[model samples]
Target chain A: MHISPTPQDFLDQSLLLIQARPKTTRITTTYSTTSPSLRAKKTALWLAKKGKPTPPTTTTISPPTPTTAPTTPQQHTAHLTLKTYDPVSGTTIQFVTREIRDVGRLVGVLGRAARGMGGVKTQPDTVMSDAPVPTPTPTPTPNQAVLHVAEADVPRVGSPAPTAARIGTPGPGGEKQQQQHQQQAGGSGGAQGKGKKKKGKK
Target chain B: MHQQLLSNEEFFQKLGLLFATTTKQELGSVFLTQKRLTPYDQNPEKSDTKPQEDTLADLALAETPGPVLVRATNGASKQNRDTKKIKFSTLIEPDAVDAFYVRYAEVCKSGMTALKKKNRRRKNKKKASKATKTEGASA
Candidate 1:
C-alpha cells in the first residue's frame, strides 16, 4: 500500500492552487455618447453645480467608490482612445494618451471643440484674449426708475441747488452758460406753491 | 495574448491612483476616439441594404471615473479607404476637471429626467392615437 500525502503536503498544494489562479480580469468599460453641444452644456452645467449644494438623491449617480477595491502603489499605462470626426476632412481621428494631465488637456480641448472653436493653433494667452467676454449691462428694473441727471448742471460745492449736470462741451464758459440757462428755467418753473406766494409778495 | 503588459491588479491600482490624483488635485484626463459607421449597420436585419456609411453617429463620452473619454465618429468616407489616427496629448490646468465633476451629477440627473420625459411623451402620444382610433371605429 502506498503512503498517503501528509497534512503539510495538502497545505502546500492549497497554497500552490491559490497562487495559480489569475488575480485580475481584463478590461472594464464605462462610456457615453452625446452631441458636442450637449457635452459642452453638461460640462458647463457640471461646473456650475460645484459650488451649489448637491442633493442627497444625486448620491445614486456618484461614481462607485474605489476604496472597496484592493489597491497598491504602482504605475501602469492605460490606453485612452479618443476619436473625433473632421467634417472638412471626411475622416475620423483617434487620439490616445497615457498621461493623466494629457487627458485633462484633451477634455479642455474637447470642451473648446464643443463650443464650436475648430482646432486652430493658438497660444493659451491668445486663446483667452480671442474669446468674447460677456459683460453684464445694468438694466433698470420695472419697479425702479433711474433719475436722469445732466452732467453740465451738477451742483457745485458752495452753490447749494441740485441740478442736472451739464452734458455739452467741457469748459468754464460752457458750465456758466448751462448754469444761467438752468437758473432761468428754474426761476420760471419755481412760480408754484411757496414760490408763487414769494413772487406775489415781491 | 496579453496586449497590455501590466498585471490586472497593478493596472487597476494605477487606475485607482489616477482617479485619486484626479479627484484630490482636481485634474483629470480626456480620451477621444472616432470611427465611421453606416446607417444600416445599427440594424442590418431590418434594412436589406449594403453598409454605405451614409449616417454619422459620432462622439461618445465614456463614463470612466479616472478621465473623460470622448469618442467621435462620422459617416463613412467614399474616397478615403484608410482610417485617420490623431494622438493629441497635453497637460491640462485644474479648472476643466473642476468644472466637469461639479456638474457631473446634475448633468446625469437632467439627462435621466429628460429621457423619462421623452418616454412619457411617447406613451401619451400612443395612448391618444389609440383612443382616437377606438372613437373613430365606434362612430
Candidate 2:
C-alpha cells in the first residue's frame, strides 16, 4: 500500500468520484488513470486509424509501443455523467461524457474548483447541513425605531458641524463656537438676500 | 470491513491519520467517494410532512435538499483477504468538502507560508536593531 503525502499525490494514485445534485442540477464525474499497456494499445489503434507507418525506434524518439510506454500515465482520464432533474414536469434527463483525456480540461465545463465547491458563500445552491437556520429579518418595531433614533442622535451630539475648527475637543467651547458660526452664516445669507432684492429694484 | 459513521471532526482526524500511516504501495487502494444525499436520507419520518411540490419549491428557494456524504475507504489487501479494511463516512456540506480539497492542495504547495513570513520579519527586525546598536556604540 502506497501512502500519498498530499492530496494531489492521493488524487494521482487513487480514483476520484464526485456526485453532485445541487438544486435542479445533478452530475457525476469520475477521474482515473489508464494503465501503461492500455495507453500503448490506444496509441497503436490511433496510429492504425491514421494509416501512419511506425517510425524507426531511436534513443531520442521513444516509440508509443507497449515496451516503450511508461508503466502508468502521469494524469487521470475523466468521465462525466450529467443528470438533469425537473421537479415540476417529473422528468429526469441524463448525459454522460465518453472518456475525457485529461481532467484539467473539464474545468471549463465544471467551472473552477474553488468557486464551485470551495466555500459556503460561493455554493448557495447546496444545502448547508451544519449551518444555523437563518432567521428572517425582523420588521422594525416602535422600540427598535426609538433605539435607532437614539443611536442617530449620539453622533450628532458628539460631533458638531464641520464649521467648528476645533471639532471633537471635549469642552463646551467647541459647541459655543459652532453655534456662533451657524448664526453668522444665517446673518450673511439674510444680507445677501437683501442685496439681491435691491439689485432687482434697480 | 464494517462501515462506521463518524462526525466531521473525527472523520478529518481519521483522514489525517490515514495520510500519515499509508505507504506508497497502499495508495492505490485508498479511495474517497462523495455523493449528494436526498431528503429521505436526512430524516425519513419528516420527509412525509411536506408535499412534493412544497418540498421542491423550498429546495429551489433555499438550498439543496440535504448534505453530501463523503466515504473514505482502503480496500482489503490481497495477501490478507480476511483483514478488516478501513472504512468510514461523514456528512458535510458540499461547499465545505470542496473548500477542504482546495485548502489541502494549498497546504501541499506551500507548507505554512504564513509562519515562514513571520519568522523572516522577526529576523529582519533583530538585524536592524543590532546594526543600530553597533552604530551608536561606534559614535
lDDT string, candidate 1, A45-124, tens digits: 78678865433433543222232122222222233444443332233333443333333444444443322211122236
- DockQ of each model against the real complex? 0.03, 0.05
Query: A33-123 in candidate 2: lDDT tens per residue?
Result: 2333455668888988999965544557533333324433333232333333334334444333333222233322332322222223343
Off by more than 4 A, model 1: A1-75, A86-89, A117-202, B1-139
lDDT of 2: 0.46
Top TM-score hit: 2
Reference contact recovery of candidate 1: 0.00
Complex DockQ, candidate 2: 0.05
Q: Candidate 2: which docking quality band?
A: incorrect
First chain TM-score for all predictions = 0.21, 0.27
In model 2, the runs with Cα more than 4 Å from the true position are A1-29, A35-37, A45-56, A59-202, B1-4, B7-36, B39-66, B72-88, B93-139
- TM-scores vs. true structure, each candidate: 0.19, 0.32
* lDDT of predicted model 1: 0.34
